[model samples]
Target chain A: MREFVPPSTRFVDLPDGFAMHRGGTLHGARIAYETLGRLNAARDNVILILTGLSADAHSASHADDPSPGWWEAMLGPGKPIDTNSWYVVCINSLGSCKGSTGPASVNPRTGERYRLDFPSLCIEDIADAAASTVHALGFERLACVIGTSMGGMSALSLLARHPGIARTHINVSGAVHALPFSIAFRSLQREAIRRDPHWNRGHYDAESYPRHGMLTARKLGMITYRSPREWEDRFGRARTERGLRTTDEPFAPDFEVESFLESHAHRFLRGFDPNSYLYLSYCMDQFDLGESCGSTTGEALSRMDLEKALVIGVETDILFPLRQQHDIAAGLSSGGTDVQFLPVDSPQGHDAFLSDPDRFGPPISKFLSVG
Target chain B: MREFVPPSTRFVDLPDGFAMHRGGTLHGARIAYETLGRLNAARDNVILILTGLSADAHSASHADDPSPGWWEAMLGPGKPIDTNSWYVVCINSLGSCKGSTGPASVNPRTGERYRLDFPSLCIEDIADAAASTVHALGFERLACVIGTSMGGMSALSLLARHPGIARTHINVSGAVHALPFSIAFRSLQREAIRRDPHWNRGHYDAESYPRHGMLTARKLGMITYRSPREWEDRFGRARTERGLRTTDEPFAPDFEVESFLESHAHRFLRGFDPNSYLYLSYCMDQFDLGESCGSTTGEALSRMDLEKALVIGVETDILFPLRQQHDIAAGLSSGGTDVQFLPVDSPQGHDAFLSDPDRFGPPISKFLSVG
Candidate 1:
């Protein structure tokens, strides 16, 4: 939601091991994360970030290496998140592979790769792990739990499941409830992954896994994640290799968009786990915050004891249009919550959370400063 | 592009044979066309219609015991074109079925099936054939020639190839120039046809040609022919046999849009000629008027001697946008031709030409209103 520019960060061993939805519990879960700015004497300036699908908790900084974190530019020092003043936590999600327990991790029971043996996980379990990580750091309540896209869902879920644990909550580019169209797009992505020949029904050796499936899934996901207008502006029938393709045509890519997809998917395959991808994606699908709570969105908001809520939306986000944000805002406002709804105008589409920092950074800074 | 509700019409056969592009060759080519309303004296009320890739000259009326024409509703009596007064002749282009020489026709060369020996008909070649059909009917000139999508290209080509043919021209949802993206779309469609086991590299047995290719082409074409917004509107995450698709689910068409694609493709296989589709698509890809005429659109229109022209466009027609129509109009106007441009708003995309007659029909009637 709010872009976090980090100041400084730290890594720690979760004293209370990370727990998951799967029956098999894990031991010694470590979080590779960052802390921005100076922690207040009360240790109450903490904000946690949940990453989107295929992203690790490395939301703000590079800990062990010079390789900058995914959103490091948006979160570090003088950046949006302003780690310079507030303590921020961005751990590698429990089921992620950024030095986290996942399919590639050793299964304590079998002494082998978990692979498909990993039990299906839901968003509630992810929230629990994140809460555990937060508690292990000696924090009683979070000043705010902010997330974007999938992370946004996690942020709201964190608040919903823990109830009053977060003084304030922020969500961007997602809904309190997952819509059918959004879930449908996610379904196609996972299907593309599982249908790959090398997927081995999720039992393949972690080394020789179904990379093509992941790539296709990413390509398809990319289409839904962005807009045709973006493609028109970025590519616009520009010829590259004496023709039009940029990647290894046929097998790789032809158009500039195709090439971008290839590189993006490859980057993901490097640090992400395919099985964990399924796990996280499933968790998102299971996230229906309003289902049991209430019937209408407004009714759902009334059910929550919302204190301070910041809902950020992007204008050109076709994946989840601004209407959803406005709807959430209307519901919260009707329920008398001090909600700050910031809708950033950006043609970057759904990916504007990363691309257009100038618009999102200011509102997020204002929201964080208000407290 | 005007849609017309039809009235009772007579099928007319021109006395002079239609000519192929192979120079002065009017070899027993009968012009099979349907004419509505009475031809005014000086033959000034005549509006000639040209066929697209697989379409015949039957733009409105059906021959006895015949098939319903493509633009019937929009061309009928009191409809947009109002056949009650305006004389309309839908001339079946030369290289098509439904009464024209095509792959199935017997060639004078060795008196056998033209098949592959039909000399790879180009867009200009078809334009010449259409010119012959109109001239054979004894109309020294036409009030206008309006075509949709592929037919639009043919109308433009006719003006450029057969100078002094029409007083006004309407090119709807078409490109003055075929971008590589245009060819890229065609390439994929042709690839599906070629890959069909039955196609056998364009030499399949006449009886059981590849219907699978036809289906595949249709499936892919369906995506480009409509807006994703329309698809979302029609089918939002409704499930059929599959359970509600979530983020973790497989890639199947639970939404109505996915089903629409399948059904559209399936219907295409039921009523279409695979070979004709291949040739027609290729014609569209090769439709670079400047390349075909060895000059620019302005130079070509300069030769047409047009008095008035209306370049119609569709807003959601991704295949060709309003900018393209503007380009055509600019070219024609620059050549000293009177030009009027009207953009029709329709969510049906390129198919708006056939789907939304209200947009195309009345405007055409007003343009062709003869005292």
Candidate 2:
């Protein structure tokens, strides 16, 4: 019910009466972000980092916040995305509970949480917000725009909607549009959240939150994010010493993998707002870059005027399969963009970008280091 | 919480105090089954069919039942199993709700529904009950034992535990043991059912069934049952006209895939007993063919004494991937049993045996016809 914003998070106010892609307008809406490294005199060294669902603006620890970030391994002084050379600006997604104006945020006009009353969100709106943040920072163009997971979708939207916003792009486990399988997984997650009686049509307060529903939704999300191969190697029929048991429940988390999911779900429960989660998830499902431009996905990709691009996909990603990354690469290649499509055989599935930085970092670092 | 048995279903009672694999016993317990053809005078010309978690004994329609059964396409007189030549007996899994003495059944000792009191069920227990059913029907051995999905695990158990129970075996989308991925999936499903407030620790009755939990569990099952490739071809990003909406919920089933899962989940909700479902799903996760015989999976598989075996796997099956089938075939082959590993490139995934009969039928028919 409450947003979990990092201490270092800063804000960029959108223009008054900012219109949403699917309709309605926001007054005094702002995007949350955090900056690392210093901008050059010309501002051409700026690297705009867009994030996936469930991430905040704190991509890494900086002077303002010493806490380790979600991408601490991949974004540091000498990491893949070397902060020393580039002025990195990571933006929290618009419809996220993490320091962003989402369903959890107070509606300025009504002075209440937006909840279900929040406007229908789209990937384009998220893209527009990120663009606005970049412009507000006085950067006409970014040296590179990096997007991972849902951020990949937003990155595509950013490039397609606002051509030349970035000189180069890096799409990590992203997609042009959600496949039916991905949609099915996300739809089930939303259903899990909504089906809880405590959800009370999005009216539950802090004490009466839909804990069970959110727990189930997060558990399902964990399953999809990681791959079977990684689990087989990591948890393979291993029993958990501390059983996830309640009274009279015979079927509890006996397996190590189930325990892993339970622990992760527990960590996620307090950090996110259920309503905000639903809105962002629905936005991802609705995102179709081709639909935004009224053209085929290939045509839409060909429209992006980037000087260079990098599309990285994990072979084991079930949510955004490797073929989707191939499609993006193929489309961008057709556009005469210097595109590098790196297919990583990481066993971590869709979450490889976050977990298997060794495989992900080199390609990103090499791509960013070039030109 | 009621069992939905076909009118033509028959029961074969086990001896007093039937022992379970994991410990505990079932007194006055019976196995539910239905036959498709006459038992030949030799009785050696019989095929025993074991089913997945939700299936009953009614594999096909009979004169008494009239209604079509689950495998209506492959089990009639002239169908793939060829009832004219093979007297086929399809046994409902021991822990299922369809006319079997399961969690939903009345406990003979207490004269009350067993519910969670149903002893720790295992694949070996299902196999033992199935073996007892075959023996009580006056057959020392079968022509072949066909196991599909969970039944495939049961079949492997049947063959391993009761060596020479069948002359030949067909393992369809089965595994020696569940992979961690499959366990995670089944664990979440059980969690979904148990988390339902109405579940009441498996005491939920007709009026207070855990509808939401069961719906979510069934929807997740449907997602894993079929392949992503099939959904891509069938649904893509297609929207549903009749949105699966409830009052005040914006994130309803919007995509065709979501609707498809929703419809399937709804149909299954009324048909299955949630307690029985949880018990059976747990049984699958606990099943390890090696654990039963106190050896490695390969070693245990080699212990099965059979003249021939055919392991059929679908390329797209995420639940029981193709490699598991190869492992089964290799193990059986190592035992000097004539084994054929046929990997079908079917897009229907784990449920291909039930849905994509075109790819599944020919191999089964050919395997049955030979010798």
Candidate 3:
């Protein structure tokens, strides 16, 4: 499959023979990013925004791309990470297909899509790549670095591996390492894709894409991304107008929630490359902040140098529970960083930071303004 | 693809032209069951056991079948159910493959497996079949009806439709109707099975079985059956001896939890018919006590004539959360039935009743002793 890059996305080529964290090198590789607002003369008013899995650098619309981006509500002028006051740079994670050099990208060395031939990706690699992009943008130090979900893990890695890269950090719904439950879910999702005959060891074309596998994976993800209580209130045993007998299959979508999942899964099918998904998901399961530094999670977190930090978590997020956020706060505070942990009671679960901007926007804006 | 019946199971044939709850007629349908201990001349000491999806009539070992049954720890001569004091009868659910006339059973008229040709099964049909079995045993009423998970829904239906059939009821981790979250998960599971090319619209033979689909479905079920906290304690980032690179596929099972799911899924693949799984899973999602009687769930539950009731729920059970069990208790109490709602603190989630017998057994034994 081909990469899905927005026309307005800008690129920053890595120096030749860029070394990957888990032992591999990429030649002629580049990072995709989009910047809004202008850096001040001193570049001290900059904010770097790192995203979670499946997001692109196009976080919000700029003059180049007027269309709204994924996190449009929380970005843009006068928004949470206000472009009016802070020059914001959003970098697409290295292993994603959204304009970044991932498995979907053509390998310069072999002139073929990397696919399984791509070196194993890791969270540290994604962090390092983002760090490289920061340096390439002529910034000696970022005023603040914001990371959400998987990007939260990347931010921690950046703060630890490349010390003094940012003055302050915002960790949102992120974890130092994946819990066993999350690993099991991701493992099964990868299995679903690999088991699809059309997947064919990542050699699938558009005609034989793993549609069913991707659908199943995305549906499972949708089930986990939102809280059960939210689903209960929104769709309590509600039936869909498309009756169960609409098809020859006896187990057709009957409940409204089933239809909801079907539409969401279908929308995601063509947008992502299955190989890139496998690589990034497996990378998350393998990420361990403590293991990277050869220390305990608390010890590794305590070694980071930051003036201040803000950690936000949702009460209903099953994927990255509140306790993980608490750990992040406690660890950073131990290192003499002024840390503020805000646990929001949003029923949207892990995806609350994206969907419920009202609950997430205030604290983020307040933190950046004070910084 | 065929019925998997225990050698010691007994059968009770339904009367000719037996009607199903959803709409259909079965000419030679039968219910499978097994009994232990002796019923007194008054037949007032009889207890009927209704099982959840995937269980058979062989709930516990009998004189003829020495093999330990699913509930062997809790049902025996001196066990929680205490067969020596109360004669116990365990009935295989109507649409299950274990010694019951489900989709896997042969049709009397066509001499072929019913498969998709089988009528759409409902919880009420399973309840009605159990009621028929009880009457066949010459019992006017059961001293108590014990149901767990899906069986909990069936027991409610039996008590409501066949008034005075069961004097008391024990609902374990059951719901009046499936929540949207639970429905979404079950829908994905069914999709996994149906999307398998080998399924062939339920016409798969032994050589062409949908193994991958069933494996995915079973693994998903295993993940939801237990609590995340339990997995965190049991297998936190533990790696298996088998390396990730052992297979050509990069996404192979590497974590201990993934291995746990794989072994469990493989063990279940050949034991049950895939068609039966699709039927029973859909049945559970479709079951709503309120809709069955054209009343609200609370109203339908309040109409049941029970002298005593015990509702048990595990705090961590995502499938049938404690709130659902509380509703059952409240509804039953409104009808003037003495109700005890026990919320277990076991970390076993929905399967706590099966795995944490010490916590679950005491309440069950005490309730039966006083029933």
Interface RMSD of each: 6.2, 0.8, 0.8
lDDT per residue for candidate 3 within A303-352, as digits (tens), equals 77799999999999988889999999999998889999999999899999
lDDT of 2 by residue, A1-371 (tens): 55599998999998888899989898888999998888888889999988989899999998889999989988889988888899999999998888778888889999998888889899999999999989988999889999999999999999999998888999999999999999988988888888888888888898999998899899999989999999999999888887666646678778899889888999999899998889999999999989898998888898788998999999999999999999999999998898999999999999888888899888889998989
Candidate 2 regions off by >4 Å?
Answer: A245-247, B245-247
Which lDDT tens digits does candidate 2 get at residues B1-371? Answer: 45699888999998889998778999989888999888888778999999999998999987878788999889988899898898999999888889988998899899998988999889888999998999899999899999999999999999988998999999999998899999888888888888888999888999999998998899899988999999999999888886666645688877889889878999999899998998889888888888888988888888778999999999999999999999999999988899999999989999988898988788889998999
What is the interface root-mean-square deviation of candidate 1? 6.2
**Tens-place lDDT digits, model 1, residues B178-287:** 55434444555665566455766556665767765675567657666765455556654454565445544433345455455557777656455565566567666556
Ranking by TM-score: 3, 2, 1
Residue B270 in candidate 1 has what lDDT? 42
Error of 2 at B162 (Å): 1.1
Per-model C-alpha lDDT, please? 0.66, 0.90, 0.89
lDDT of 3 at A4: 88
User: What is the per-residue lDDT of model 1 for residues A28-62, given as tens digits with 9 covering 90 to 100?
Assistant: 55555655567899988888887777665556544
Query: Which whole-number lDDT from 0 to 100 does residue A234 have in model 2?
Result: 98
